[model samples]
Target chain A: MRKEVRVAGFGGQGVILAGVILAQASGAIEGREVAQTQSYGPEARGGAARCDVVISDKRILYPKVRQADLLLAMSQPALAKYAVDLDAAKGKVVIDSTLVNELPDGLPPVYRVPATKIAEEEFKNRIVANMVMLGALARVDDVVAYDSLKRAVAENVAPKFRDLNLAALDRGYQAVEGPGLRPAAGANDAPGAPASGGR
Target chain B: MSEDGRKVRIIQGNEASVEGAIAAGCRFFAGYPITPASEIAELMSRRLPPVGGTFLQMEDEIASINAVIGASWGGAKACTASSGPGISLMQEGVGYAAETETPCVVINVMRGGPATGQPTISSQQDIYQARYGGHGDYEIIALVPSSAQEAYDLTIKAFNLAEEFRVPVYLLSDEIVGHTRERVVMGGPIEVRERVAPPKEGYRPYAAGPDGLLPGMPAFNDGYRLLVEGQHHDERGIRAGDDVNKSAALVQRLNDKVRKNIDRITDVERVDLDDAEVAVVCFGSTARPALEAVQSAREKGVKAGALRLRVIWPFPEKVVAELAGRARTLIVPEMNIGKLVLEVRRSAGGRAEVISLPRLGGALHTPEEVEGAIMDAVKGGNAR
Candidate 1:
């Protein structure tokens, strides 16, 4: 199967890092083929930045997202710019509700995850907002499992911030759907572990 | 996999090239960093020391290229990398390295042309610059990688080819391949050739044997008087440019050595070409879309195939010639304005219709865009 995802936001929002984490999880942890490419305007920060990822069980011919199956817009401008061209009815659009408060009318299925606000309030660290957004994405997108995403986050971030990133991911993931994917025990369950300890 | 276990990770093309260089026994790196290619130098700065290699960030591209030559002479497999402008600055050093027969690697992560055109973008504009950049009539090997995995594998091949041929091998990459991150298996059995060590009695640095390869490298501290003369040198590395006969022969020998071994240096990939009516010849990141377009065209009942060039240097003329013989039309899609297409047209030589599908600015030709060209070629739309 083939899946393409585009993540866009302002610079320093870690849009590229989120895409990298997603791709690494799909490719390294899950043993799939993946490619992650990014683009940014001419500015160190506060400019438009985006990363495109393509994941496939087979070799990915066209690396870039020809048309995004999913668009994770972390800002208002990103949503406004991307949502228009999207296949509204078919594609999934997840916006960070904290920054992107007003979504344009005549939209498809839109899931709201206030990643930044949750990062600031619950986690007391705004840096992990991207992780929160990724968590929410894993919940909505059934292509990749949450366990794989968590493992990728651990590999990407430094050791000091690994636990924080993983926690933010878990919160964002459960934020969209309470036990949306597997059972609640699956979160802490090790891979290939026998399904035991049922009440 | 080396002594250690297998290592599979997501790495950028530049970072992968660094890993390949280390695996291929490249111990010296001297470069002036530029956009899209900066990660190579940054990784080298950190990765080289631990592996018993030296990383020197030179003042400029010219100095960086010169330092690479010096390091090679000092018995280190060395390399330097840059974008278009830095490569332009190192043109003189390139000719010098070719004339002196120094075994080194110079990676050109090509960007938009003529100057520092587009640092953060991708362009294959340096096809001519890589093959015929220097003033001298010499042939250097160039490997063009379309993906991060090839970027790693080809870099190791570039160093091996440089050592075996005793010439400056160019890893001609671009921003897309350099910056894009992909799955690259880092540890495996890699083939690395050792530098030839000649007899100490009578060492001729500029002499080629029956295999058209110059004698073993005369490392500076290896107890041999070393003289590396850039301007037309004789067998003993003496200043023989004044000797018209010897100078001309030396220059011709430099060209002949690489040309004679072109068969081994050329690397190309053919997909579904046995019954192809139209062939799409592509390299670099452009090959990705070209391959997709070929398959998409086949779905549309067009007999199309794709030939992806792994090693862009030595022109891969033989394979292209055979492809031209089979395919009725040949389409060349590239980021630049019809550079490699010229070679294709010449090699095709009326055997097949050659078309140029060029994309400018920062964007690459989409698979749909390339398929349109394939359809056009099959319908005899852009036959030239």
Candidate 2:
């Protein structure tokens, strides 16, 4: 089986790094075929940025993601831009509730997690918001094992920030089982509605 | 393989090229910073010095290519990389390397262009430029890699070919392949070809041996007084610009060296072409979608296949003609406005209907688009 994941946010949110980590988890740690590609623009930070990761049991033919199976939007602009590209019927949408305050109607099972809020309130650093979203993604989708992601996070992040990032990942993973935080099954609610239950 | 057994890692194409260069004994890298290809220079800068090699960041692409040529003459495997604008600037140097018979590698991680078009977007627009970018009549070997693994493998092959043929070789990668990260399996240590040195008695630098190719070159500082110049030179490395016969012979030898060994130099990968009614001809990153389209078309009972040109230059004419003889139609898809397709048509010789599917605007052709073209080719059914 082949799975395509799109991670999008403004630059400096570690969107590209998150995509790389996902690719490493599947490709290097789990010994699967993976391809990750990102868009580079003139703006270094605070501009629109996105990355696509393709994980496959066999070799990947087309590396680019035509229709993403999993869409992780960390910003409202990214959500507005890439939401239409997701598989509307079967694709899963994961968004950061703190930043993306709006959601388009008629999306596959949407999972909302206040990634940046948890990163700032608990870890006192908002840069690990993408890691939080990744953690939540692992819980919603069992395509990639949790151990593989943890190992990938440890291997990819900077040596100095490795500990805090690991903590952020754990917190994000635990947040999936937190009170009222679950994968909403086909429920189209307001933009910042709390998570319902796991898919 | 990381100094151990078989190793696997996730790396981008640019990074893979660096690893491949290192494996191929490329110790000298000189390049100016350019987007899409900058990561190569960055990795080289960080890696070369620690491996007892030299990395120089030249002021411009001209200086970079010249420096690479100089390093090659100094008896070191050398390379330089850039995108389209920088590659255009280095055309003069590339021509000089070709004429002077310098063995060096030029990596063109191609981006969109007529000029400074798009820095980060990918394009195979440099297909024509790579083959005929230099002034005058000359042939250079160019390889197109589709994935990170091929990027690594083909780079080693590029360096080997550069040394073997004594010509400036090119790895024509696009931004998509250059920047895309994928899983790459590292092979065992590659066998690097050592440049042969001439005997002490009666050594002529530019003279062709019995095989009609220049003799192995001695390094500049290796007790051999060498005169390396862009102008036409005689067998003894002296200026022969006034001697028309000498000039003609020198140029012919340079061209003949590669042309004679075309079959050995050309590399291509064919897929599902046995009973194919339609064939998709493509190269580089574009091959990814083309292969997918071919498979999808086959599922729908269209006898479609694909021929991916790993070695873009030397044209692989015989293979193209053979495929044309078998398939009823040939579909050439490229990111450019119809560069390689023209070559396909020329080689096809009207034996098969050649169709061009051109995509510009810095976007790759999706499989759906290529499938549509394949379906149209099958429906047209106008094969002679």
Q: Candidate 1: how many backbone clashes?
A: 0
Docking class of 2: medium
Best by TM-score: 2
Task: Look at candidate 1 and tell me the lDDT of residue A146.
Answer: 86
RMSD list, candidates in order = 4.4, 3.6
Summarize candidate 1's per-residue lDDT along B243-344 as a digit string, tens digits.
999988887878888888888888889898989998999999999999999988888778899999998888888888888898998999999988899999
- Winner by DockQ: 2
What are the per-residue Cα lDDT tens digits for candidate 2 across B39-121? 99999999999999999999999999999999999989999999999999999999999998999999999999989899889
In order of appearance, the predictions have TM-scores of 0.94, 0.95
Say what the RMSD of model 1 is: 4.4
Report how far residue B155 has shifted in candidate 1, in Å: 0.5
lDDT of 2 by residue, A1-199 (tens): 9999999999999999999999999999999999999986867898888999999998898999999999999999999999889897668888898998888887777777899999999988999999999988887787698789999999988899999988888766766433244433333433434645434
lDDT: which candidate is best? 2
